[model samples]
Target: MKPRSLVSQSPTSLKLTTGCEALDACLRGGFPCNSLTEIVAESGCGKTQLCLQLSLRAQLPISNGGLNGSSLYLHSELPFPFRRLHQLSKSFHLSNPNIYADHNDNPCDHVFVQNVHSVDHLLDVMPKIDSFVKSSRTRLPLKLIVLDSVAALFRSEFENTPGDLRKRSSLFFKVSGKLKRLADRFGLVVVITNQVTDFVESSDGLSGLRIGNLRGLYSSGRRVVPALGLAWANCVNSRVFISRSGDGICEERREDDESGSSSVGRRDRRRFDIVFSPYLPASSCEFVITREGICGVG
Candidate 1:
């Protein structure tokens, strides 16, 4: 009997591209597999756009900055944006014909979209993805799982109920444990987007500033913190923040436009910051959401 080699038995070392160059560079390649990366930001800060782009990017071959695997997207706050995803796919395929030539076969086929409304719905559906290892014989096993806006369901069911704080805390740990297990066992990249809440002023006067300051749409000149509190915060492996730096309006700024203007109406002057990560350093870079996909602007 031959002994198993360390390379073969060892877990896969791969960096899932975030579908954005500057973002990936900030993340030291991209969101690392076998961990949970939380993308937290205020509403309309390109959180969903990044998630949508990732669904497609995860389907590409590793040579083209993908895991060559499928994804499971748990949509919570909004309906699945298939139209925007289609636009991104079309844009990428046209730019790299040879790479995405089999474009007729959409990556959406491999990517599963689940609309979860309540905690019950989420708990019921999540375990099903684990069954793929046994039932899936032909397709690539699941590699990525994204939960957009993890705070919506719990905020309604858990936070509001009287004396349910403990329950809510435990519930989060349960879900987090499952996700951590799935990530470690299956080498899946679990990325979750969390909504933000107004930062409560503390006696120290540093409550808002300590968490991370944003001068964007929802900031309203007052800082905000990621919702779901400390219990939910302890579960995530990486937390990335998205915010608009200048003008706070998210629009495209094209220099070649008919008007000889310089960054006139572009609102998407966004920043991607790696708040904390064991493997990746704390850094930030700017990117824009264009028709094609998330691209490094500066």
Candidate 2:
């Protein structure tokens, strides 16, 4: 007889709060544990901010809308934004005093960051994270893993090569499988940020009519789609997109210390669209980024 498998095969619904109320609502509680969630957005649209916020939120106990664990953040293209994470940690600590009452203990200490310069480095480091998660005996268990800008590593190496397509596709499956396995085995919420590529109409003039960069992720006459093609899309369980409004004007809320002018910052209108997901609806929500965090559009 063959040896029995050790890992659990069933899926889980337990989630970690994203820490942003509007984003959490959009995700229907939070990012689902034991699954991979992808966040795709244009530059300067708060992808890293959201990731940073989630790192802090994941540290919250289960009763307080958290996974009661720590997070692993892997960045390939950009340096980890420490200032923003610290700012958000300050706010998060103030709100959840019970969990972070100690003034000396920093919330950021719970988040483990790994910066990978190349794809091979990333592939190598991921398995080590699995090892840490499995052997971790700390009070806070490992709960989340974040890869900011997943496509950048491939886009540079692949360089629009047809042969590299197969290679890229293979790497996609391999990395995603590793993450998925870890998620199922230890119930980790995997979040990956992907870059975008302009969806070019390549019908070779067979059709006269054009649909304005029609693509699978876009809705109602849209342009540009998430990069890394279908293989990457299939690997992730959920895809949440963020885009800035044409005007890029976010609402201004009054603060006690600041005057009306000081309160009003360049708060751009951002749309959080759930392009596709098994549990989440094919819907979108409006939200803005502030010093506090992601807030409702209203």
Count of backbone clashes for each model?
5, 2
Model 2 stretches with alpha carbons more than 4 Å out: 1-12, 102-104, 204-222, 248-267
TM-score of 1: 0.84
lDDT of 1 by residue, 190-233 (tens): 99999888777779764444432333213434467788877787
Judge candidate 2 at residue 38 and give its lDDT: 90
C-alpha lDDT of all candidate models, in order: 0.76, 0.78
Best by lDDT: 2
Query: For residues 1-298, could you state the per-residue lDDT of candidate 2 as single tens digits?
Result: 9864555543447888866677778788889988999988877778888888888889988988888899988888766788888888888878887775553566887899989877898888978987798798666899999888788777787756778898889999998998899998898999999877666777774222222222344322245677777677788988888876553333334332356556434346577888778887667777778898877755
Candidate 1 lDDT score at position 63? 82
